[model samples]
Target: MQRVLMAAGISEDVVSQRPSNRQHRLVNKTLRRLEKLHEACADPRLGLKSSSPYLLELLPETASALRRVWEPYRGLGAFTGPAPGEDEAVFLGLHARTLLAQTDRALLLFKEAKEKMFDETSSYRKDLTKLSLLFSHMLWELKAIFPGDRYHGNTYNLTKTEARDFWKMTFGNKCLVRWSIFAEKLRCVHPFQEGLESVALKATLDLTCNDHVSVFEFDIFTRLFQPWGSLLRNWTQLAVTHPGYMAFLTYDQALSRLGRHPRKPGSYIFRLSCTRMGQWAIGHVTSEGDIVQTILENTPLYLALLQGHSQGRYLYPDGQDANPDLSALHRPDHKAKVKVTQEQYELYGKVGSSFRLCKICTQEEKDTRIEPCGHLVCRRCLDSWLQKSAGHTCPYCRCDVEDTEPVEVEPYQPKHKQEKESDTDDDHEDIELVVKQMASLRKKAPERKTAQQ
Candidate 1:
């Protein structure tokens, strides 16, 4: 694992050197000091006024350690240096650190805000609001750094405009303030609602946070310190004299499998598949459905280029032209006329219609498909029969079916497009109404208090 890390371009010197017993003792002492400080802060009687002299002294030391760990590879230049081979590993390490730091900082701020909110001080509300703003800024920074829905593990990356629109949908137009107000009001109504609101708020704050901190920390550590150590270990192992000293380490990493092309589908090629003396053959399909093989290259290049040309033929490695047989290329025409039965013809006729209502459901419903027996059934009806029946056969045909997977269909769109969709407009209006209702309820609360007096 250490050798793998080094080969992947992580520095060996940093990871290979084990800490001395004295250093371990120092770490233990520091941990004990931190634990004492934590206990002092946890005392409820001291509240926010809890202070530890040791904490004040230890913070500077912690910061110094952090700087030592991160300062060398803090910027883009760390990965863009002269060594092209190590660029990818360096970039991965840098990105991992950035993500770690951002998540940790956000979590710390969240914890601090939660603590401050329990205080009876008048400034707590204002401080909480400021924390909310800071959270929003952090969210924005995260989005900017890792732009697009693809980064969020979506199907594809979004354009700059789409990203802006996504940001608007998530946190735009005082959404945080509105959610906070709603949550506060809901607290008076139900405990479940309050819990739900708190969960939602926390989820919104850390959108893509994962519980794999240890894995990332280990990877970062390995990447930072294994390269030089690996070299030293390799040299020492090789230096040990023996009668049959066979060097086990071999350079076999150059071989790569560039996976199959989408057009060619299943056929794959490897980098080491090409031979220096092999001949390249080009197969062309003739008008009469015959393939003609011709020698494209006799003295071929050692490296294989798996990319396809404009004519849709992939450049592949071929064997030597030994005993060339043109008779193998002759293909007999086996085209047969497909005769549709009366029932199948009727089913085809039904499918050709503009609309076919599901016979099993209401007349207004159009979710219908023609079965093998030329009968139309709704998906729901078909699903019910498939579930309840032991045979799992088609409802109309009663044919012994092996599988009941639904056929893929193009998405249905209405012929007449709407001038303006009401759903989004209605949603916006509903939000406005809710905000107004909340404002009125707040006003009435004060009036009700006055009346009771």
Candidate 2:
């Protein structure tokens, strides 16, 4: 109950929850010492050398205290282990105290605006921006306490082809990125650091095909939530629904107004799906739950829709242009289908006899063939080659074949009784040839030796 009140802006003196004696003393000492440290650090006259000498005397004791306080606060275990004793009480109490203090400061600024009759002469816009920044921070910190730990590919490195695929999925086609502003800054810490190591994760989204990139970043001290779609939706909802917020701040002109704004405060709901092949990393944020749920609900189907539409198959294509040529590319298909003569095929076929083994597939088979330019490829290797090698020409001879198709092969029979006729033919040929040759050479043959009994 005291913790709740404290969170609700009650004073520490008014907190009825009694903490353990040791913890109470520890909290008071730490807070007081921390205040002193801040004070000393801020003093302009104190040089680093002088300050360090003074601080060194207290370092060992301070370090011990800091370690004691930090044990629970450093990890997920911070959420558990006991009832509201002094350490927990002080720690939780500080969060509310800080927010309440900031809220009061914001309210003071807001009151000043009202007193000035909402006039342009007042520093109200500046004050409002400050208030927004503070409120954003407060909300940010509250959410950070138990951040979603799901990883998304955004936090890690990617292969070029994989990146291209991701880019195509994220931004290409008829779908454009919805304009956004008033982004929440969030962060995640790299756990292992050597001596004040601060490795921070940067978040960004690339809207490809559309050719755009957006970025969001925060200090590594705060743990971050991943897939931030829901968080983004919630944050956007809060910013947008705060009626006339942008207008009041004189920032409406600066923000992107891509479409109609929502009038009420609520979650921006959507269905998402992500690919199974996508990589994931640690310390990602999700607005409400695991990122897998967001991916399952939003990404897959959205990508499929984007892909389908990009392929020129829309629900209502009747009013659209009949030609499927991409206006942006400016290249027409008329040049792709020039006719070639049968004599060219015959000439190539004759020259193709010397070819063996595919150049690309590199299979050591004699089943290779060539085109008019004498480029060689085995029949089995053409399909994959055609799929990826766009603006097609034969890899080996650079032949401009009008049309190429996959070669079909018949099934082979097993070596059984079906081979009897082939064996008989071979025997008949060998017998006659050998007998005639032996007769011709009979006069020159050596006599066989008698066997010893």
Who wins the lDDT comparison? 1
The root-mean-square deviation over C-alpha atoms between each candidate and the true structure, in angstroms, is 30.5, 26.2
Tens digits of per-residue lDDT for model 2 on 89-164?
4333453344344444545554565545244345754454434433433333232331242112133212122222
lDDT of 1: 0.30
What TM-score do all the candidates reach, one by one? 0.18, 0.21
lDDT of 2 at 295: 20
Candidate 1, position 129, lDDT: 28
User: Against the correct fold, how does model 1 do in TM-score?
Assistant: 0.18
Q: Write the per-residue lDDT of candidate 1 for residues 35-121, one digit (tens) a residue.
A: 443444344642432111122333343433433433333334232222212322232233334334443443454356565544534
Clashing pairs in 1: 11-225, 11-226, 11-227, 12-225, 12-226, 12-227, 12-228, 15-225
Which residues of candidate 2, in runs, are more than 4 Å off?
1-87, 111-123, 129-453
